[model samples]
Target: MMEFFIQGVLHPLLMPAHLLLLLALGLLVGQQGVGALKPLCAVLLLSVLLACVSTLHWRLRLDLEVALLVCAMVTGVLAVLRLELPRWPLILLGILAGVLVGLDSAAPRIPGLRGHKIHMLLAGTVLSSTLIMLICALLALMLRHLLEGIVIRVLGAWIAAGAILVLALYLLRDRLA
Candidate 1:
């Protein structure tokens, strides 16, 4: 149980797609200034919680990785562009990213792990994911003044490029397999 919980906690940090989407969302929200933080965070939290709960009953049988990568790519591009988007769009993006993260972070079906144990695993994931998002957003906000926003843009570009590369490799691997 402890091991499963620990795995859940580390899921976002370990998964490339999850990490990228979180970072991209954080950076984009942070770039929008303090005003955008509350709404986006609220939306993200609600969406993630709902999606995680839904995963316990019926896991979506779709290419969630590809969807996550695409969301990350779009968010990264938005960050790089530094567009001053209105609050609604940012909130919408937050919701989308949160749901994807939650859906993809479902615990693997291991033998004998049932009921409360699975919930504990997902609880850890939710806690860690939320913390990571908050930390990333706060860090970006703090560094915004020091770097004249260049660092955020660079990170966003890197995230976008990385997503594209990974997506390509993932698709090719599927074909080859």
Candidate 2:
């Protein structure tokens, strides 16, 4: 049993398990049910811990997507609160943040854009990436405002996405089982 545990499980693949737990925690918090805050706080705290773990000298690297997702959520919440801020700018910032630190393979190379002035080039790339996310979010906010009828469509899309993810999880679980 111990050998089986060591070889088949308790490895890097557990990362997915961690993500699933995070998703469940977020959805539960959004629901605002009993004991919600506890789990929400725990999830947020765990995320921070995971992020920190990735930064240390150990071999394991924290996944960039987790960091991006956390940042995205934080910025999203902030954007909603600070309605006065230009929406497009905020969205563009978000996209840049997401792409730069998003654990995507292409993110790091972008910093080397300029031949000799690597620092300047990288900074520009990061700025551009963030600008794109902010733009997208801003556009989304604008569309939400302009077409009142589009909200239904937005809601439907969100629901459909959730359903698809659930189905995917179920299929994966079945295969594993």
Candidate 3:
């Protein structure tokens, strides 16, 4: 039980793509000002719930790894560009990111989780994802407040580079496999 809980907590942190996307998203949204945070977080929670339910029971067949990479790339670029999108668009972006992360994190069929109740596993997954997202957002907000804006842009560049490299590896996965 402790092991499963730890696995759940580490799920987002363990995945490079998800980690990058969450951090990039937090940075991007943090730039949008304090007013955007509430709606963005709400959408994130809703999207995660939707993904967990759908992916677990229905086995929604989508290339979620690629989708997560793509999300990371887009959010990274948005951070680098420092483009101030309207609040609504950022909310939409949050929803999309949450869904992708949820799908990627849901591993109901994994060996450790095989005998666990679906709801129990999903609850852990959701909790971990939300915790990570909030932490990322808070860290981004702190950095934004503490340092010059250029630092955030540099971080964005690094995130983008990481996403690109990961995407390349994923593309070549067939050969690597």
TM-scores vs. true structure, each candidate: 0.92, 0.31, 0.87
lDDT of 1 by residue, 1-177 (tens): 787678778988999999999888888888888888788878888888788988877897887999999999999999999988988888888889989999987667788865778887888888788777777888888876656799999989999999999999998996878
Predict model 1's lDDT versus the native.
0.86
| lDDT against true structure, model 3 | 0.78
**1 against 3, candidate with superior TM-score:** 1
Off by over 4 Å in 3: 110-116, 145-147
Give the clash total for candidate 2: 13
What is the Cα-based TM-score of model 2?
A: 0.31
Clashes of each: 0, 13, 0
Candidate-wise lDDT, in order: 0.86, 0.35, 0.78
Candidate 3 TM-score to native: 0.87
User: Which scores greater on TM-score, model 1 or model 2?
Assistant: 1
- Misplaced by over 4 Å in model 2 are 1-60, 66-117, 149-177
After TM-score superposition, the amount by which residue 19's alpha carbon in candidate 2 deviates from its true location, in angstroms, is: 19
Ranking of models by lDDT: 1, 3, 2
How many clashes (backbone atoms < 3 Å, residues ≥3 apart in a chain or on different chains) does model 3 have? 0
lDDT of 2: 0.35
